[model samples]
Every structure is written in C-alpha cells, then in structure tokens.
Target: MNLYQKLVEIRKDVINFSKDTESFGYKYVSGSQAIAKIREKMDDLGVLLVPEVKNTISSTYDYINAKGKECTDHIVSGEMSYKWINSDNPEETLIVPWQLYGAQDDISKAFGSGLTYSERYFILKFFQAPTDVDDPDSRDTSNRGKGNKKGLSEAQVKRGYALGFKAGYDKANVDKQILSKFNKKIQDLTKEEYEIVCNGYEKRGGK
Candidate 1:
C-alpha cells in the first residue's frame, strides 16, 4: 500500500477517537493521545510521521494593568510542518503546513504553548479527528427558567462565558474595550450575543 492509502486507512480507524479530555472551554483529544494512536497504527503500516517547527516570530508588549502595575506580554507565532514518510520508498513524503499563536506573561511559556497548540491541531487536522460536542455549559439551557430575570442561568453560563472570554482575550487577542461596549457582564449576555462572541473567538483560532 502507498502512503496515501495507508493514511486513508489510519484516518478511518482513528477519526472517532473519543475526546475524553476537556480544558479551556473546549473538548479535544490531547497531543499525547493523538500521537500515541497515530504512531501505533503508522508503525504497523510501516509509515512514519514527523513534525517540526519551520519558523517562528515573537513579539513583546508593555502595558499597565488595572492596578497600575507595569506588565509585559509576549506573543509567539509559529509555522509548523508535518511530514509523512513511506518506509518502503524513502523518497516518498507528504507535508502539511499549520500555524500556531500563543501569548503569555513569560516568553518561554508563550513559545511552549504555541508549539503544543500547533502539534495538537496538526494531529487533528492531518488525520481528520472529530472533536466532541461544545462545552456542556455552552449547550445546556435546561436551567434557564421561563421569564427568569436572567435569560440564561448564571451558573450554567458562567463557565462557558469565562472560557470564551479567556479564549477571546488570549487567543483572539480581543481587546477588553471591545467587550465593554456590550455593556453587560459576560454571564448576563443574551444567548445570541454570547454565541456571537464565542464564534468570533473560534473564528480567530481560539480553538
């Protein structure tokens, strides 16, 4: 079998790998999980998968915090490449390109996070793994009582909203001032508006 045929078989086998892990307001298979599964099958098929950072860019911003303390934020972006090699024919290889961005108070954290993020998605996209449903907090409206003062239950909305806010702020690089224009706390945002924010964040590669 050729590289493409082996890859198609691998995708069929692992595409439904359960997203048993959750964090950061999203559900996804971790890099370790995906890699383990992929490596296991690829080895049996006599194929190899390799990932490398092709290039990276880093930037720092200095700003004042709400408490008037000086703060520095570092952002790093990377171009990643994933290679599939056929053992039988050393010359046969396929490459997929991916991009990643991460920001943090520490420069090392920023780059580390960027690399992990890139690798995680690279596995998912390259093999077409399925992500589980949206976070439960974003989906369950059962607690939303009819004619309740708040359209959405506070408890149910809080987790999702917090996740969305952090993702928007961190990954999308959304400005707090833009959110302030909405004139309401995140939990108080109408369902429609809240979804819009979340969607925008994801569109900006928050996920």
Candidate 2:
C-alpha cells in the first residue's frame, strides 16, 4: 500500500477517545498514551514519521502565583515540520507543519511540555482520531461541554475567567481584552497563551 492507504489503516486502527490523563479537574488523553498507540500501528504498517524543529524562541518572566508566592515562568515558542514516509517506498513522502507554545517554571520543562503537546496534537489531528464527543461546532450544547474547536478545555476556560476576574476585569472585559491583545477569543487561546495572560493578571493582583 502507498502512504495514503497505510495512513488510512492506521487511522482505522487507532483509539478514538481516551480519558487516561487528568488535569485541572478533567480527564483527557496523555501524549504518551497517544504516541504508544500510534507507534505500534506505524511499525506494523511499515510507515515512518520524522519530525524537525524549524525554529524556536525562548524567554522568561517573573510573576506571583494565585497563592501569593513569587514565581518565574520559562516560555518557548516553536515551529515544527513532520515528514511522513512509506518505508516500503521511501521516495514518497508528505510534509506536515505545526506550531507550539509551552510555559513552565523550569526551562527544560517548558520545552518538554511544548514538544509533548506538539507531537500529541500532530498525530491525533493528522489521523483525524475521533474523540467520542459531539462535534465542537454542533449547536447541540450537550456533548459540547468537553472540548471546543479551539482546543481549550472547559476547566481551562473556567480558570482563565476566574483569574481575569480576580485581576479586576469582569468576564466581558476579560474577553474583550484577550481579543484585543492576543487576536484570539478567550475560548480560543492556547494553554500557554492563556497562561501568559493569567500570569500577567497575577502580577497585577500582586501589585
């Protein structure tokens, strides 16, 4: 089979949805879990995926956490390209592009988190893995409670709104400010992006 045919098989074989990982009071699939499953399928199907980091930038900032403790955030922004090839016919290949941002207390952890987030999202999206939840774009509001098209978790949204409120901006103002500053809706902000906004708010509250 060619690359497309092999990829279709992988997609068919991969897991749809998993709640093996938990964070901020909700459960979701972890990177390790997703990678393990994908790797197994790829190996069996004679497919290889090679990832290259095209560019990256890093910085650090000091702030206070919600607990009033001083903290430093190490941040990284990066762009990546992944090449998908059929081992049976190495001449045929496909290139996929992705970007990621990571923030953490440690520099190494910041990059690590970004890489983990990138790999998980890249594979899941490339294969079009099912999440078992209703379409995020659907008007149904029932299963829409889990995740949104922007990739923000419900818990993250709640924490962001609460942090913004504590920082002196009400929900509407919070949304307006995020839109103006980040060029993204509050619900559309990436985890790292929202963390930066939240950290900024924490600093304001500290002052």
Candidate 3:
C-alpha cells in the first residue's frame, strides 16, 4: 500500500479497536475511521480477520471483512466458528452469528449484523490523522441518542457480546469468574436491551 493508502488504513485500524461497539445504539463510524483502527493491530497475530468481499482488497482482510460474532461453522461454509466464554465465570453464552440479512453482497456491506469479533476483543486507538474529523463532536450537544455522537442501539451490543464469546473471551472474567453482568444491566433496560445481552447466551452453529 502507498503512503497515502497506508496512512488511511492506519486511521481505520485505530477507530476499529477503540470500543466493544456491540451494545446499545452504536454510532456511525466512517470507512476512513474504521481503517485507521484496523491498521494499529496489523502488527500483531492476535487478530483473526475474514476474507474481503472485493477482489481489489480480497488478498488482505481489513476490518471490513470480519464477520460479527462468527456464527457460521467453519466446516459449514467459511471455515469459521466463534462462541463467547466468560473469562470471569463458567456461565458462558454461545451466540449464533446473526447476519443482518439484506440485499448486500457480503458481510462488510451488511450493516446491523453485529459487532465484528475484532471490535470486541480489543481497544482500537485511532491514529488521529491531521485531517480526520471528530464525528462525535459534530453532533448536537443536547441530543441524547439519535446523533452521530450517539452509539449503536441495544441490538448491536448483543451482537458484540456474541462476537466476544465466539472469539473466546469468557463471560466477563472480572475476577476469574464467568459472569454475564450485562444481562443484569439489560434486564431492566428495555426489550431491545434485553435481547442484546441475553440472546448471545444462545448457541450458534450447532455443537
């Protein structure tokens, strides 16, 4: 990749690693930003990304290629499998990867599917290129959840949990105990909130 392109990709890598991005009203993150986050982790082998949908970018899997909470059984199709295990507790939940079914050609094009495993497993630090915009800052200060400053809805959060589980994090291993504390957080929130937290507990790709 050229310097300009590499610079752009670096920006994407950082933003991608910044948050869990799975629960409750995830906000919009531009392609550039996502790329910045993706670049940061390219240096390490801890990441497991999916194949790209486009031939131009197919050879290398950027953040755009990974499936949110790898739900498909590797033997079944893409040679992939993911399940969230609580590092804090044994009460782990198996999340079936839920792809946002639509007219899109592949996983990257499909929004609302869920948080990609990469997004959940690490904290993405944006490169903060000289020209990058602070998207959150552009939103209305008074606005609560509907602006760019807003975040992924409750549904998205659940998808992230699934990805984390599938990636093998173990349910919130706070003190070496498996626990889905988010379940409690979602339990009193709303139906959408509840699904995001509890549904991931269900299995994906039959055992």
Query: What are the TM-scores, per candidate, against the unseen true structure?
Result: 0.60, 0.64, 0.24
Candidate 2 residue-wise lDDT at 50: 92
* Steric clash count of candidate 3: 56
Which of the two, 1 or 3, has more lDDT?
1
Point to the candidate with the largest lDDT: 2
Deviation (Å) of 82 in candidate 1: 1.3
Predictions: Cα RMSD each: 7.8, 9.9, 15.8
Which has the higher lDDT value, candidate number 2 or candidate number 3?
2
| Candidate 1 per-residue lDDT over residues 5-52, each given as its tens digit | 988989987887887777645676777897788788888888987877
- Tell me the spans in candidate 2 whose CA falls farther than 4 Å from its real position: 132-207
User: For each predicted model, how many residue pairs clash, with residues at least 3 apart or on different chains?
Assistant: 0, 0, 56
- Model 1 gets an lDDT of 0.65
Q: Which lDDT tens digits does candidate 2 get at residues 153-182?
A: 443554465555546666678889988999
Residues 8-96, model 3: lDDT tens digits: 55445453333322323445444444545553444432232332221111111112222344232110011223333333332433332
Off by over 4 Å in 3: 1-29, 32-127, 130-152, 168-207
Worst 10 residues of 2 by lDDT: 134-143
* Top TM-score hit: 2
